[model samples]
Target chain A: MERPAYRARVERILEHSADTRSLFLRTVTGRMPFYSPGMFISVKIPLPEELRIRPYTIATSPEDGEPFELIFNLVPNGRGAAWMFERKVGDLLDFTGPFGAFTLERAPDRETVFIAEGTAVAPIRPMLRRALSQPCSHSVHFIYAAAKPERLLYRAEFESLAVTNSRFRFEPLIVQGKELYESLSDEVARRWVHGDGERRRDFFLCGIGSGVLKLRDLLRGAGYERRAIHYERW
Target chain B: MARIRVIYENGSPERTIEFDPAAAPFQHDGQPGSVLDVLLGHGIHLEHACGGNCACTTCHVIVKQGINSLSEATEQEEDMLDRAPGLTPTSRLGCQAVIEDADADIVIVVPRYTINQVSESR
Candidate 1:
């Protein structure tokens, strides 16, 4: 069952914000490969010297097949981002995977908290979808933090889910002006992360390397066990 | 193609196996087929929370023997090892440790405990 490399074609591209875009890729085989939430795929883009492989988290759920989705922010000097930006519809792409251990744990009947920063929301989106679809009694709290309100991806989708799903709550933290550090600190304090009675809580974090690590330290200091904190950082 | 001998020391009733490089990039369980892939291919379920993508350190193993036979650790791998629980000079991520020497065999020691809650649950 070794995951094999597949040829995919770019089906469409949608601009989510000023700098964020979502690429939809459909396998040339006319079928979607098996993948789980939080898992990522390594896309191979040809460069002058050699092929550059970049890992991108699958944005849409597994059931949303055919054209798999990947959301990314345009990094100024990133080779992958630059190549991706130049891709047009029907362009061929080579990739391998459906890898990573960032999938949701089968912990039913417990509180689940997801803290996503910017495009880190890609992995958390599928997990939230799975959580809502399952027959679990767990409550979910998703806090999305972005540098600015415009940088927040999937804000409307999460907000709509919160309105319809009683067990779900969505909060957006926009760090504008001088309120960057204080906002995150205050929001974490306000959230009831601890579970009641014998039930346990799980926290999933995704974001840039430093931010994810900082939040992990903060959560650890807040009496959360190391095992309960799951993270994926880029 | 190289030859790799794997010793599973910490599983239920220890076991050992050999891997042929020709059969390498061994596909099992829909993984990318690394040492973690080879081990899991034979029913040895190591804790690989990152699905052998080297994103996490859960699949770390100590190369008790044949360290020189493996590929050199990348800077990213070294950085991740800093986060792993046990500190050993020979420690390597199972997913990233690819056997490169044809004449050498490898012996691996799976850590007694891994801290990934999701993998532990699985």
Candidate 2:
């Protein structure tokens, strides 16, 4: 079936950094369809000439209930970002989905590693939460990378989760002077590689196109199963 | 029913399948009766990173024949198509290009490499 477009009202906007913001949206009419962590929603922006559609990852967990959230960076000259920037509290917007197949495992069957850069952490956050909530013996790790400290979205939230959850570990990779790929390789080696062979691992990576590609290649080169490494890139 | 021929980039032999637009919505990934729908419904692997929302270009496919039989590309689809690798005059996002003429045969070429290789994890 074609995904139905649902109307939602912007309830609030939380400024995360100079370039990043989170929009909390509540369904205005019909109920928002059930969604998992990695699924995203495509927003409808009606320009004078034509309608423009852009998809944004839902940042909040389904376990959190109503007013699901979307985290995004304001791209210069980006039509979708511009339209989103123009939205205000109580303004209604039309969207479709809760779509995409980048969802998490039905049950925690192995150690989970979430690697993200910049606003890509939006989807990883909910996935991390859901992974932690389930009763599993394996540990979960999150390696978040950004060019600067300010760009590490949801740092506090992740840190808090790491502290409260015994099985969770959070690491921040700041790519200032080093190559992102090299730094990621070093980090992945230190955290995951050279580890116990008995531990089966699954990786979820999201970021700019190049970074995600590099990380995925690094993992695949290390002998991880192709299906074990799941990713989404923009 | 129409015959749909799919050409692969990895030197795999081309294959054709019967597609009936009336048996639309074979899956929920893209527009009903779309080339993506028909191909994926028949077990063809097409990478759709944005769940066929026209948000990503991983599903890019070149129309080799019967382009006129497919729906015209929308402005949003055109914008995304601009970023696809190995783009051509006939390039179209498989998810957005619905099969409008059921009886007319269609042919599409799947590129060797997409911008994103790791498709969605089911």
Candidate 3:
């Protein structure tokens, strides 16, 4: 497989939230390779003691304008993630592969439901746009659970999408008191028609491992087929 | 030690290699020197990313023959694979994985996902 060769430089870095940074890279060669919306890129960073290759999910569409975008969360101890959080604006990085199979395939089901937390929003953002682009036969909704409002990454973007697209329903769940989340799980579930006679719901569950389990259980109990509940857990 | 076979895509054919069962599993787990030790001794440059420390998928090879011959996935390796995109059931970390087989040959393919890069993407 021959990949497009290009020189990559960090064009823009947005401190969207306290913990997350959106690094926009401009491909100087201008050969924008095509990629699936939910795919990922493997970034190869050469260091002295250890070389690093960290795969981060693509946050934008097959965006081919000035800056190719990549939004990543900084894991506390992860080597590459820590380094990226410390990278300068004009720094250069090598990369390979927009590879992955975790993506949204359109189903005949009329209602679309998505659930994610934290950086999990990266892969699903494009699909959210596609779902809310027009008045489709389906009703698309999303549930986002986060540590708090402070750590929420795309507050403005999601809010705007929810406002403009009437078909979209977005719920940003913040961890309050001892209740991490699932505190609003019932409220989130009430929006869907997931009773006994209703057809199975398609759930795109993205997050860390534990949250994905909760999503799986809730969807499974409501008569959704196991296969219908797709997940891309971190 | 285990036996490993790397099949090059668009190359002459397949090549068979053997590692010492008594020696340590791939250098990353704190083994010494090169993964190319046996291969280089016999003249084979199995493309390894990062020299060989459970980093990067560049040297990725699909285990076409005997995946069971390799060591089990370490925690570090498994976490790395979680983000490796286009992951498959037969996929093994070539750098972290070492041979433990004596009777059979472990076959591998270089998956296309290892090479392609999006010029502009997420």
Candidate 4:
């Protein structure tokens, strides 16, 4: 609990979906903490009687420079969601972090699979970029899921990256209702289950608890080593 | 009521607090009456990056005494705990170890080193 909490102002906001948004924050006081691509920031929301702390992943990379970005959904009756959705330009909020161990290998020796469902793309986006960046030779596949075609957050960027970067592959899946987890599991199986075992693969999963855990188990059942998978769930 | 003694890693004075297990969930982050919930309720901050979802091992604590009074670790908790530093047979994630016995006396030690990459404040 020794990390200093710094204040930042909301510089801009981009609406990705009806309920999802990406907020750009610029520090108002001390310098920004150096962070890895997959790290997160903890925001403290002051309630009437106590302060509630919530963690949000930094969507932008440290190499991209400030102001860093955070994407989130407006959950009905969620205290953290309400506080985040209410912010305006110039409004200040407190955050402490750049914390998380969910990062990629500096030089991957195998195919890196990045999976995201809903707003989980926030962390996966930067990871995909880092893996595909120059001097790092590795195949990186991104499987993004949304309820509908319109809800695919950062689809344009992913698609563009796929087109221009040979090492990057993007697949967007539209999942609705109860079949969300099933669709993702089936997709993973279809793409990876029968593939040759000679090529080693590593997985990075970020999403809701159900989807992340489902994928984790699927990979585990497939004989993937526990160390080969990394994830973050909310 | 149960007595909980917490020994710090940074040379801070050890603290002992009392609470009724029946009145659980003193804090919003971990399980009700869990080590994380109880400690945070008494103005002690234990790092929990995933907010006690058992996703991260930041809230790790070693049960120096009364390990039997805490709940058994789930499979998922065990998987994540494997990644924790300074792990021990009595190690438990503060958020997942619920105090099952109301009058149980437990002592825990916050390890000096942790693998959680984030620094935090209240």
Query: How would you encode candidate 1's per-residue C-alpha lDDT over B11-122 as one tens digit per residue?
Result: 4555676666546666432234356767776656665544455686667888888898877886556756766767599999988877676556778887765534223233
lDDT of 4 at A228: 85
Kindly report which residue stretches of model 2 are placed more than 4 angstroms away from their true locations once superposed: A105-107, A194-199, B1-122
Per residue, candidate 3 scores C-alpha lDDT tens digits across A50-159 of 55556677787764355767877777666677777877789887765665546653432567788777788887886676555556766677888777786677778888
| lDDT string, candidate 1, A13-118, tens digits | 9998767899999999534556778877778778886555567889998878868898998897877788888888999988766656667734335788888888
DockQ for every model, please.
0.12, 0.09, 0.18, 0.42
Report the C-alpha displacement of residue B25, candidate 4, in angstroms. Answer: 1.7
Q: List the residue pairs that clash in candidate 2.
A: none
lDDT of each residue in B1-122, candidate 2, tens digit only: 88799998878888899978888998766789888888888988676656676656768999999999999997557656766769899999999999988796988898886644322112
Question: A116-221, model 4: which lDDT tens digit per residue?
Answer: 8878888888888778776557788888887888778878888999999888889898887757878988888877875545326899998886777888888878
TM-score of each: 0.68, 0.69, 0.71, 0.92
Per residue, candidate 4 scores C-alpha lDDT tens digits across B14-121 of: 999998988888879988889999989888878876677675677889999999999999766787788787889999999999999989999999987666542332
Best by DockQ: 4
Q: Could you tell me how far off, in angstroms, the CA of residue A141 lies in candidate 1 after the best superposition?
A: 0.4
Question: Could you give the interface RMSD of candidate 4 in angstroms?
Answer: 3.0
Residue A137 C-alpha lDDT in model 4 = 72
